[model samples]
Target: MHPTIPGFTYRRVPVADDVTLNVAVGGSGSPVMLLHGFPQTHLMWRHVAVELAARHTVICPDLRGYGASDKPAEDAEADGLTYAKRTMAADAVALARALGHDRFALAGHDRGALVAIRAALDHPEVITHLASLDVLPTLDTWDVMHGTGAAVGFHLYLMAQPPGLPERMIGASADAFFGHFLDIWTRDPQAIPADIRAAYLAASRASVPSVVADYRASAGIDVVHDQADRDAGNRLRMPVTVLQQDWGTALGFDAAERWRAWAPDLRHTTVSCGHFMAEEAPEDVVKAVLDLLTR
Candidate 1:
């Protein structure tokens, strides 16, 4: 059995025909769902979930095609929409409803934040509040990347290629590929214990293809969806909070300004931490989530 959030019960909740997310739910009071980032599972929120559970029901789920959750096979000819944020976001909503929540506050980190953004955009009625850790919307993400600075996201361009190559290459050395991020994107080396690091690598190694598909969709269909929303002038109606590393000065884009366009009632904070904020700075993350909920 995988390491789980203490006090949270685990279950497989069906969100789609062939997809059931591995979910860890605990606490009571108002409901708040926490989505985990890439190369990790809901266990990433083990620290924060336990803290938030003191005053709120916290639901954490291993997204479809990730962790111990079901990974639906996609043929080579597939369009990559299967792992798109729109689809993934729907899975989040369905999982919440399956757990009897018609409306709840939502928070996500890294890749999971993309799904949370799309969920608030597409189903505003279902998400009462939103918190995104370390990510911009799809359209804004592509807009900010250019020249040498964009090299940081080499994996994005790598996986954005036409299917076969990215999957084969990543699958070939899955541990090293996924472990690279866990090593470098962390400020506090001890933030993730040896056991948790091993769990991340193991889970990521087992789901390479689906993980690649998830990123590939981010580069393709997700961009299209965000563009359409931009053209339509759709914005997040709920209160939104964003916590991110100070990447603007290096990347040459106003991170908060970009977020302000989508989130009107927004609190954009630049944290002194690495990409894995939940693990590296769980106390700060929990504070931000609690503050957002109060808004």
Candidate 2:
């Protein structure tokens, strides 16, 4: 059987036309929606979800095109819109509404953070609190990424290429491609047990194209939408918190300052953890989320 949070009830909730998300809901109280990142599924939130569920009804869902969620076929002409964060953000909002929530706290890691950012910007009325773990806004990300420093993100550029090549390349060695991030992005290897690691690889292997489409959107249409928001001075109108590895100096940008421009009431913290903070340093993540909820 696939790994799942022990006490959560699972459901396939329709979020869009011909698309439904695989969701795990547990606990009761104020609702909080959690979105999982790439190379992982909603199970990534198993630890955090359980902890948060003690006081809040936690909703964890595999974002569209990832994990067990629906992956709609994308026509070439769609121009990455099918997997754009805006599209995924809408799916998150829809999922929350279907789950009997009109507005809720939102938190995401990596790719999911991008979707959370877009959701906050587009549906401010629906997101009451926001937390982004280890990522910048799409526009800020592309802006700060440059030169040899950008080499760390080789996968980003790879998936950004026009459809076929990326799909074929990643599909050819799906395990290695996805496993590389899983292996290197964590400091506490024990945080993800053998079964969990296998589950992640298996899920990623099966969704190579959809996963690439998700990343490709970040490099293309996501940037455009973020740029449009920036041009209009649109920012997240909610209590926002961000957690990240202290790599801003190496990347030649002030992480907190960058986030401050977008999130006026932002609480940005630099942690000594790897990219998968939610799994590796779940207590820290939980504390941050709990604090944000109070704000």
Candidate 3:
């Protein structure tokens, strides 16, 4: 059927070379692109898109290898055209451009949040405003958490395993494997309905290898990009808003301060939700995005 959000139409649009993305577009006004995270689809923005669509054109897209998007086999040295953050960011940029938006406001959840950050850094001319949900920068995430705190992010390590292992293991019980994160990462289980959860599991299961490849690239090539940005002193010049759980207190960091190092005009807040803030707290997520756009 459809996602939890009511009265929205789904369409698949070709974005980059050899790739097309499943995107949900509705409402009418200034464009706002919403990118979903790991193990989820554009459906994650169901609630938030419905509300934002009332006043703005909401474009939600499933990133490559995640939902309905084309999942190319992993090629480690694909000449900068793999599922890494840079390529994924290009896909988003192409998607927006194909949708006739030279510039747009962008908000992303979890893994998508990392892509959004890279988009802002790499394609500053096209992204006007930026918002990240429930994730820190790649370098910050890897650097800040250690010991037991790092253990909580076991998926990162698990997905980083050599080819065929993670995919084969996760594929054995795909639903349970993907569902475990959905069940534990969110404070509100009711946020994602039964049918929607089933859809997520199905999509995630079919794309296990690609999913692992995406994460694997992050630990390797993605970090290279992040480090380059750090070395170049590149920072997000646009107005940036971040809504996340208070991982800083648990991991010994001042989250806002760390983000400020990357985003000079940043507004960071810790919400009362778990990792899936967009699905769990859609209204707040929408409000945060709209506020950033307005400011």
Candidate 4:
């Protein structure tokens, strides 16, 4: 029972033959896209999308393996190509163009943010502005994940292991695993309404293999992609704004510095919220997105 933004109509956008993204569209004006992260779908942007829709057209899509989108199984021979952010980002670009939006402002949360990062790097001409919530580039994410902060994201490492084992283990208690993050990553548990939590748990339970493969890809091929970007000196050239908690302070790294190296025109700030900033701090997130558009 994942309800979309009130005034939005949900549609299946064909991105590839085997891949069709579940997208919610509403309002009218310059387009703005919102992407959801792990264990959730386009519904994660419900609150933010509605508010933004008043002034700008809103497009919210469930990243490939999550929500109602097509979940292609793990492809060992494909070398994690199915769930790589590069491909996921391409899906977003194709979705935008399919809807007659050649360019738009974009913002994504958590895993969705990772996809947006890749999209901006690859399609800077299409992404006029970018905003990332509670995440770093894939490479820096692994780097800062070390030290005491590693405990906070143990699931990342767990899911990163060989696909089969992680899939079975997570599938065994999918609701518990999904609920665990919802409870811990918010300042106010009420931030995530009960129905929303239940929907996320249900969606995650149904796509265990794809979810695990998504993370597993991050550990393998995703790293290779990020490393390639670093070596080639490719950076996000669009105006970028990042809002995050002070994880670097607790995790023993400088969050802003890591982001600055990748986003040359970066506006990074520390916000007072937990990992789920879009849900826990919607006002802050909305303001940041609007600001990114202006910047």
Per-prediction TM-score: 0.98, 0.98, 0.96, 0.97
lDDT of 1 by residue, 1-66 (tens): 668899999999999998999999999989999999978999999999999999999999999888
Ranking by TM-score: 2, 1, 4, 3
Best by lDDT: 1
lDDT of 4 by residue, 1-295 (tens): 4555798998999997789988899989999999998768888888899989989999998889888889987777999999999999999999999999999988998999999999998898999999999898999988778776689889999999985789888989899998888888878888889888888888899989999988988998999999999999999989999998866467888888999999889999889988888887888888888888888
Least well predicted 10-residue stretch by lDDT in candidate 3: 1-10
> Which pairs of residues collide in model 1?
none
lDDT of 3 by residue, 51-120 (tens): 9999999998889998888998887567334878999999999998998999999898888988999999
The better candidate by lDDT, 1 or 4, is: 1
TM-score of 4: 0.97
Backbone N/Cα/C clashes per model: 0, 0, 0, 0
Per-residue lDDT over 141-212 for candidate 2, one digit per residue giving the tens place of the 0 to 100 score: 889889999998899899989889999989999999999999888888898899999999999998998998
Go through the candidates in order and give each one's C-alpha lDDT.
Answer: 0.93, 0.92, 0.87, 0.88
Residue-pair clash count for candidate 4: 0
Report lDDT (Cα) of residue 122, candidate 2. 94
Deviation in angstroms for 18 in model 2? Answer: 1.4
